[model samples]
Target: MAKYSEKASEKVEESMHETKEGKLKSGSGKKVTSKKQAIAIGLSEARKEGAKVPKKKD
Candidate 1:
């Protein structure tokens, strides 16, 4: 299992949160319709923020 810091976890949570309309769209203009995509987006953002973590390989 991989480990994530509190800030990383929070960033994931905030990114996955849906609006009242329940739409999941990433900032990159991609439609994130699944939890996996949401988490991926969050982790990607966290990585860009310089959070210490491993990057996922596609």
Candidate 2:
């Protein structure tokens, strides 16, 4: 199972909302975007805050 800190989870949730509200766009000029990117963004912020977030697998 993928483990994520509370902050990371929150970020992902917000990002998901943005996508749902049509506020975010993909690089391919599409409305559909990867949720992983949102998760990654969240994890990055969590890491900056020293939150306990798991490293992303390459």
Candidate 3:
């Protein structure tokens, strides 16, 4: 497994919580229903904030 920064992990955790609460949404404005999607969203946010995260896969 790849190592994630503490901030990145926190963002992911928050996204997971939002997903469970049915409050997570996609860029297209659709509700997030998949765990993987939620994690991806969190990672994307972390990247935007300049957290120490790996580059997105092609």
Report per-prediction Cα RMSD to one decimal. Answer: 2.4, 3.2, 0.5
Higher-lDDT candidate of 1 and 2? 1
Off by over 4 Å in 1: 19-23
Candidate 2 lDDT over residue span 1-58, tens digit each: 8677787778667777877677765556666466776556556767778877877679
- Model 1 error, position 18 (Å): 3.0
How well does candidate 3 score on lDDT at residue 29?
94
How do all the candidates rank in terms of lDDT, highest first? 3, 1, 2
Kindly indicate the candidate among 2 and 3 with the higher lDDT.
3
Score each candidate by Cα lDDT. Answer: 0.76, 0.69, 0.97
Give the runs in model 3 whose Cα sits over 4 Å from its true position.
none
How would you encode candidate 1's per-residue C-alpha lDDT over 27-51 as one tens digit per residue?
7876677788788877887888888
lDDT, residue 30, model 3: 98
| Backbone N/Cα/C clashes per model | 0, 0, 0
| Residue pairs that clash (backbone atoms under 3 angstroms), model 1 | none
Poorest lDDT segment (10 consecutive residues) of candidate 1 = 15-24
lDDT tens string, model 3, 1-57? 789999999999999999999999999999999999999999999999999999999
Worst 10 residues of 3 by lDDT: 1-10
Candidate 3 structure lDDT: 0.97
